[model samples]
Target chain A: MDEKVLLTGNIAAAEGALYAGCRHYFGYPITPQSDVVEYFSAKLPQMGGEFVQSESECTSINMLYGAAACGIRAMTSTSSPGFSLMQEGISHIAAAELPCVIMHVQRGGPGSGSTQTAQMDYNQVVKGGGHGEYRLIVLAPDSVQEIFDFVQLGFYLAEKYRNPALVLTDAIIGQMKEDVELRTIDFGPTPEDRSWALKIHRSPKGKSANVHSAVGIVGIYNEWLARTNEKYENIKRDEVRFQSMFMEDAELAIVAYGSSGRAAKGACKLAREEGLKVGVLRPITLWPFPQPQIEELASRVKKILVVEDNLGQMVEDVRGAVEGRAEVHFMGVFSRHMPDCNGMIFPDTILEEVKKLL
Target chain B: MSGEDERKLICDTPDCINNTLLPTCPGCLHGVVARCVCEAIDDLGIQENAIGVVGVGCHAMTAGAVEVDTISTAHGRAPGVATGIKRAYYGEAIVFTFQGDGDLGAIGLGDVLNAVNRGEKLTTIFFNNAGYGNTGGQMGPTTIEGQVTTTSPYGRDPAQSGFPLHMAEMMASLRGCAYSARVGINNLKNYAGARKAVKAAFQKQMDNIGYGFVEFLCTCPPGWKKKPDEAFHWMEKAMMEEYQLGEFKNVDEIT
Candidate 1:
């Protein structure tokens, strides 16, 4: 039986991880996402799971690395600054091919920008914040229910690919409460033969299982690099997820994600009532971006308005996807409902931008 | 004795040591500490159930030589990683961290202190060669006052660079540490003490007492600009004065 409960995005994320068999949680408390650590700390021990309030975000990510190396599902949640601190560990985890989930409850940034909501981490997360040639499976959720669902999906995809997955959210969605139906989501069987993961028992090959990031041997390193690149390509091909609405007979498509997507969706509904052919294309997977759908939409529509809570980050991807097939416009953080620090994108403001573009 | 028996006695390598890997530097004591660790695992008869979290440095290569299942963590993160491993196993596995002076005393100080403060049942083997051995002999947190290295051209000015850290003593002061000791393997007597310290540290973890730490004042001949025998003499004569041997903290219970 499934149970429905009103949950904030943070609580929903925690529940989703638990339901996904993530028995180890290592994280440090940070604003807008502390609820996740709090919930895990209170719930994990009772369930015979492990919860570690790590000393820092750096430590937290390394702990996640350790647990993941042990072939167990582990996760950590942090905000912008803390996420920045985790980049080194994330890079190592990726190189080591350890599967883990990281949730970034983004806020304004550049440097301690604001504790309020913003999508400023678009380039940082989607474009690869850490060094080296690597990509994270980025999931952007617009609502509390989606937050819960995406977190579970994140873990599944991480384990399936032996790579790290990121659930990209924001302060508004993280702090807001909504009715969430909690249920186990099965993404089919992951690789059962985890011979690569560290086990206490000696390997049958008469050698210890060593999990490491650096491959010094040139031949082995080349093989590893080839395999990792192929895995990324496979993920991109198989896991491009997005939600399209009212695009069947539309001329203008509003491309957005996360809370911005939520606002743009409301704007699309309002635009339809006013006899406008506006539609919404909300990307769920930011890295495996829905470029094919966007390209298809561009062929039909004359104009595409990309709305975001930052300075036109995702617009670059949209423009690239459209490839001059349509005129792409952007509504950024400056076009919010208010001019104050707590300003957010609202349906009315987005609709106004849509009307001007049309 | 029979020829086969003599050969067996002469080449008695621990089952936990991977014999294929090339040896460490000429006078580096990482090999000594690695043998001591493997010997401890063998003594406890937990070779199959032991896991190691190795931090980055020259000491990281030692993980390749030690045949236990190991995870090579980011520099200075072995404590955090070991904590995760120990917690995931719920003390069913014997988890330990192999780290260097720079890895532990500098970059990973907070992680080690926090792990010990949490009373996580894990063992830590810290090899302090007084400088960053892997990165070409740069000055490290444990580099002694007035010591000269590549980074410390003239000397380690206490005003410019802080005095050497007493990591084992500092760790012992923590309320969560069950056992903390500093030892060396420059001589036969000290080698025995080092083995005993390593075993005691692991025993504390096995008994679920709390965190166990053993710091080894190791020799880094190339990094210290000395020959193998000279490095051993320097460690015994100079390093020993600052980093005294013997256990700083040992208790049966948390209180």
Candidate 2:
């Protein structure tokens, strides 16, 4: 049997990062996500890694840039306001084309609304929060196991694309304890052998004279844009991941991601027992949108229900994917009235919505 | 060594220095400061292993000037970036940050102070040209009283813009800081001191001592709206008086 233990999403993320060969962790303490830093602070040193509790999110993200440029696996985590502060550094990281993982255990937003779970940062994370034209390979995880798994996958994708990747989870999954089987997956060869990485030499006379900057004269910037656009196109074509359940003969489809996806799965089961022909299409990668698969599901289903812990954020993506082939209804809930889990659209509520469509 | 060879050897400019004219305004002290720091790196023979973090400002364009590996970071976040590099590489990479007053003394104050406080073994060369140089002479945290700029057309009033910060003194007071100094780059005498300070900062990092800071009183003629030659004189007469030049603290003294 595999080694399994009850771990919170944050701890699983830390363990996953360690197993993924992350040697540096720079982070600022933030609510609902501070355990990631706490775990790394104690575990990293024992594992012969480095951990820094930075002064702010701005500093921590820049630290991520530095470590990533050295061709080392580095990571950081934060929540709403802290994530806002980190946008500038994230833009710099994207422009410089360095690979690193960033986690956002989302809370209520627009401002520091609350420390409870909320998915208001959907557009901010997937639509390039910083500046300029860029895209993060955003992986939305629904469970403690997915949190653990996505951490390693995030690093792999980050290194593979030479871009920053994010594990976008909300407070419910970040704090919830679940059984996770710890395992290691090999990511083949590291891409740091490229000429852009920093390394020690006897003199600055070799291929190691790397410069990691995004700003330059107009001509240089134009060239950079072309190159980055091409990389994003490849990611869109190759890196999209999602899971479909009971969609082959379903009359209704529920579109959800992250923790909302988990709830929608339960809702689907309840609807099935009640003999409603309902299913779920859970997107694991939010940025690429799983458009083709959603298009197929939309053709087969009579209606689509988009569920989220925020006010219709991912619903837009679902709509775009469905392309009006199916009638898409939004069951949007914001994390304002109660804690994240209670505030969310429960499985029973989702089952009721599915029955209505039926 | 022959006289010519000896002279050549004494010229410690690292090959990493972009031989092309610096992207800075003509007669700007940033060129001199860059040369001095590069020379220091060359002298220490850490050019191969050195990694620099270039802050966003006028210094952003200098990324290509150095042969060493460099990362151009967001404004005022170079110290944090360098801290990450040093932590990642630990003793293998000698990391440093080159930042200006606007980037360092103002926006980056908290990160730099905290990095120093945390005892990160790295080097920081702060270019204090008083006003924001690249941003068209805006007032900064280090803009001295009575110094006139676009933002301070009627002369800098301490009552309004507040006082200029003494970064070296503040850093030296921090427990994690191993070496802190304020140096001027106006003349040969002060220039020599600045060079030594830059070298010493790198040495401290290489020795795994702690955070080392050297604040240079750089001249920004365009920002000051003065001619280059006149700006040098102003830096000597006014800037020197307010920002005292010398090593504020040394690890040897502490030991």
TM-score of each: 0.97, 0.95
List candidate 1 segments past 4 Å from native.
A203-205, A216-219, B1-11
Residues A171-233, candidate 1: write the lDDT tens digits. Answer: 999999999999999889888877787777665246677898875431287788899989989
Quantify all predictions' global Cα lDDT against the true fold.
Answer: 0.89, 0.85
For each of the candidates, give the backbone clash count: 0, 1
Q: Report the number of the highest-lDDT candidate.
A: 1
Best by DockQ: 2
Worst 10 residues of 1 chain B by lDDT: B2-11
lDDT of 2 by residue, A1-358 (tens): 7799999998999998988888799998999899888999999888899989988898899889888888888999999889999899898888888899999899887787878777889999988888887889999999999999999999999989899999999888999999999998876765646577776664555654455665454128778988998999999999889998998789999999988899999999988888888889999999877988888888888899988888788888778878888899988674224445446657888787777778
Docking class of 2: medium
Q: Judging by TM-score against the true structure, name the best candidate.
A: 1
